[model samples]
Target: MNYHLFKRAAKLFTSLLGTTLLLSGCQSSPESIVEKITPLNPASDVVPVRVVRIDSSYQLQRAGKPYVIKGAAGVQHFEKIKEKGGNSVRLYAPAYADVLMDKAHQNGLTVMFGLWMKPPYEKFDYYDPKAVAEQQQEVYRQVQRYKNHPALLMWNLGNELDNHYGDFKVYQIVNETVKMIHKLDPNHPVTTTITDGVYAIPSIIHLCPDIDVLTVNVFNKLAQQPVRLAEAGWKGPYIIGEFGGRGWWEAPLTSWEAPLDQSSSDKAEFMQAGFKMTVQDQSSRCLGAYVLYWGNRFEQTDMWLSMFAPTGEKTPMVDMIQTLWTGQKPANQAPQVGAIRVANKLAQADLALEPNTDYPASVPATDPDGDPLRVEWKITRDVDEFHTLPQNRTAPETIPGAIREAKGLNAVIRTPTERGGYRLHVNVYDGQGSVSNNSFPFFVGVLDTPRLGIHMPQYRRY
Candidate 1:
């Protein structure tokens, strides 16, 4: 074999292996180096705006009052959907312009109208001259037609084009299209949503100069958002154009493989956590985010849309989201606590409780906005009496009050009682009718070893 050919073959093999790892969802080498940079800290007193164009940066005001968009995909529900939280709806194409604009106007919700482009990821062949003229005409027609709608929030130039191609020609087309739209509708800004993790900030900034805000679709990796945004150096206004738990691409086919069916509980957990992480943690320059597939009948996996079945029974996730966005905990629902652990051990096993011994236990909880979470602790020799504790301590003494800070309800239980086997139980109430109780058995062995003996009488006494 030629020596040069062998080296090239080796390089090809390495590249293929890396791609395979990425597609297989295995850990791959980090794509870019992370550098420490100071995050922008907006003034504490600044009032949040839902969609405000400030200089070059767009600011989405944090929902002043809890607002939930009970929206559906398509132009059908424009007039009927109450949009309890905030009045907002997203429209996909010019074809639905009259229906959507009229319905949104009547229903009192703002619209994020998308400017549809041609099929296939490739750019219109500007060199062909015919393609360029066609694109310009199409763009101008769209800009002139929808510029005067009061429901319009921002103009979406395209949807998910970044995943298919990265040609500068496409960017140039988009840049020109945005410019035309701005000229026609200068009152509204331009935006476009990309498939998650495909577009780079620098490339768009350099190529698409007329674009105003950046929107991205994210699922599953919502927790790592701050780091991802910082690394991408996204200085413009941003929004989670799509988020929630398992998108069609994310969910597994069977529970045996990886709990892929997306249980109601799991979906609820995802919405709650995702909202807190995105809106609460990164709301400074972050504009509002939209949950994906608001109302599409996806034939492929039949799982991306947010509506219920024929009977119209909303999933637990929907109910959870209503509470989160509206800040009105349901009257019958409460926080749920699960995955409880004690001393780094699973909570199901027995634990040792001795004087001066630190009995740390972690209790994870989820609350569907109806009632505030109140955790009650109880300890007794008889497992039957585990519901009642020594001092009837129901309120949190040391637990972090803020849900974001506690990392999901972890606390250390200090036993003042003497050496003995005891059953410990944690009862969590959502103040609604919903309640969850967890129990664990622990043995407090006598401190016979001198090294482990309690020296202070106060520590030894129960």
Candidate 2:
């Protein structure tokens, strides 16, 4: 009887909560809410897709008009990419194109559809004559299905085809495929992504003259941008198909074994700096760049997702991207820290100073959007000078280090050690990934003299 009653109660509670949520949802504006919750049915709204070249200088026409290609790789979190202000996606070939086209259209994002071909890199035979024919057939099927979709931006013939195998026969096949695609659909441009910008194979370039654009994947060595672009000499629009921090191949020899943690704040700063440098330096020749892996993939330990989780919380880098791309700040603002105070028992002054004392410092943050704010505390020491106590670790190491749904603007951080001077840095990140930082410098002094009346027996004997 008790078990049955509990089950009934649970069902009743769930039903009531569902009804309340439904009612609350109904109160919001219909259009805004519909955009958020609308389900996409691919078959429901398929339209004939057509691409018309605007102008050879389309990018030049839109100069300073925020002509940035804020996109991610298709393998990454697609839905999350759209939610995080990504306007385009780069996905691999024929098998994945249809579904990706539907999703991109639904989210109002563009797709750089990649053609499927495993060049000899992974033990695939591109040299086989029959294999080449089959691959062309696959490409035609994909083009026919998605060519009319509103989301189809451009079609990429292959990814890094020039990396491993140097077979001219493959280039001839690529040329033939491009010719076929042009014959079928002259609306969209066809191009292939290459390994390096500077090392363009003459045979491939001369063979694939029908190819509309040239794409290259560049990494940390963006300083070679000027030289690489000059070397290509394609006289056509180009894209930095892939550009970000060092890939697994580009890491230093000593730290090769140490799996890189791209999620760190330092990495974020490095990416932002590199991006700025590349854009400012190579704007003339570069159309736009796609920051790799908009979502996470396990390859080389999930290097590219701007946010940690796909459907979960965002990382600080997301906020940084928005700032870089849109030049807009988050709706809510970060808090400012005015000052910090420290007290210790040990001091050079006459007053009684204590050792191993606990000192409390107050921190405050604010939000402009009136949204609720949270405070995350962190205390770090200079690795070269002093060793930090167990409590002075990163947020993950400390208990309840990150506080969400916090009521007050101010929070108190406790100091565990009373010894050396330390730098206290506080990071306040809102639920939306907007962050602000504040730091304070403090030192604890040692007591110089003991109580006058209280004397040791050993000292008197001496």
Candidate 3:
């Protein structure tokens, strides 16, 4: 999950950054900020969203008051997001836009509708007049359709349209589109999602002047965003469009080139720390953040980047997020996980593994609430990256008949006979619906797999 937000701790940062919507040069103190700004638009009314300067900082203004976007990139669990103290949900596509808006509105959550710009990926020439006109019309339709919705809060013009791309025309398009949005929907502010790199800010500053806020879909360096942007000379407001731990491209991989995924518990710590560093700590100019997937999707494996499991069960990541968002702990906490071991060696394919052989694997984990832990085991082949992209995403396929036996925190798994890279997936449950998911990669082949120093470039995978 990449979508996220932080509205609960508004009081905590309001003192430090002055009040939201307290125009920088206004002759008022923090107490006067509310009186000057908090006007009401009652009865199903959605006031325009704006990014206002508060002296040296910025805050998002909604309904004539400060709004912290405790949001998610995914749309599932609107009720749960509200229950967990989130105030917004980002609808990423045009699919059932009105329906989602209704759900979010009913749940008392705001919506940031995302309109994707995919011309570059499809190789549609940016300079083509007919194509540009068609794209603009499509965007216009979306804006005109949902601009008046009471649940609508803001707009994400494009999601990560700047990774390994340098057309400059893309920035021009984003600028033009954002300008159009401001005129058609003057009430809502417009933001565009890009990769974590600050290198694109110069282009954004030069071309996309209408962008009110910059949304960075970040990984690996979640806490450093504000510092990086300031160094790159972008003084505008921003939000974390997607913060889902580390990217698969930046993950640690085995000698066989399979990535090592985090246990659910470890992921919890990582995500919690990231949220604190960015949303809670950097609220001066940072609006809020969105957790990547509120639902489940395949980035590398289901367990690699998702907060919820396929069965709608919550992982430690969710538990951690709930704790941060609401300040209340769950009755039963998810288990904390360590590494999986095979024959006394870490199950990272660092040792020799032979095909068709049955090996013992044990998981290391503990529960914070002293609950009993049960382990479930499954075997899956490594993801076939050849056929996977953001548009054509794929989860790892389970290999039937590979798991021979499963017991408490341990399993006897038979290596695949095909002699390829495989993973032993483990799920540790605390019996109270809380879980810790983890996996390790192992090669089924012999020494034919090279021991050469592996070098995987860190690319931004959105």
Model 2 alpha-carbon miss at residue 117, Å: 1.2
Best by TM-score: 3
Q: Lowest lDDT 10-mer window, candidate 3?
A: 27-36
TM-score of each: 0.56, 0.58, 0.87
Give candidate 2 regions above 4 Å deviation: 1-68, 75-84, 259-263, 280-284, 303-307, 332-462
lDDT of 1 by residue, 1-462 (tens): 999979866755654454455434522211111112121222331222245556764454333433333333445434324543545777777775776676777787777778876533444443343454455566566656655566666778877666545443456557756776666556667887766664445677787866777777677766666567767776666767767665534443211111122433456677678778765666665666665444423222233344332223344444565565677744454345555566777533333445655656776667657456767555544321123322342322222221212222566666544555454455565554444444444556652333222121221000
For residues 264-306, write the lDDT of model 3, one tens digit per residue: 7777788888788888998887898888788777777876777
- lDDT tens readout by residue for model 2, 299-416: 3332233334333444455555666677775554333323333242111212222333444545545555555666554543312111222234332123233222223434444443
TM-score ranking, best first: 3, 2, 1
Model 2, residue 431: C-alpha shift (Å): 5.5
Q: Flag the better candidate by TM-score, 1 or 3.
A: 3
Candidate 1 TM-score to native: 0.56
- Sorted by lDDT (best first), the order is 3, 1, 2
Question: What C-alpha lDDT do the candidate models reach, one value each?
Answer: 0.53, 0.53, 0.76
Candidate 2 TM-score to native: 0.58
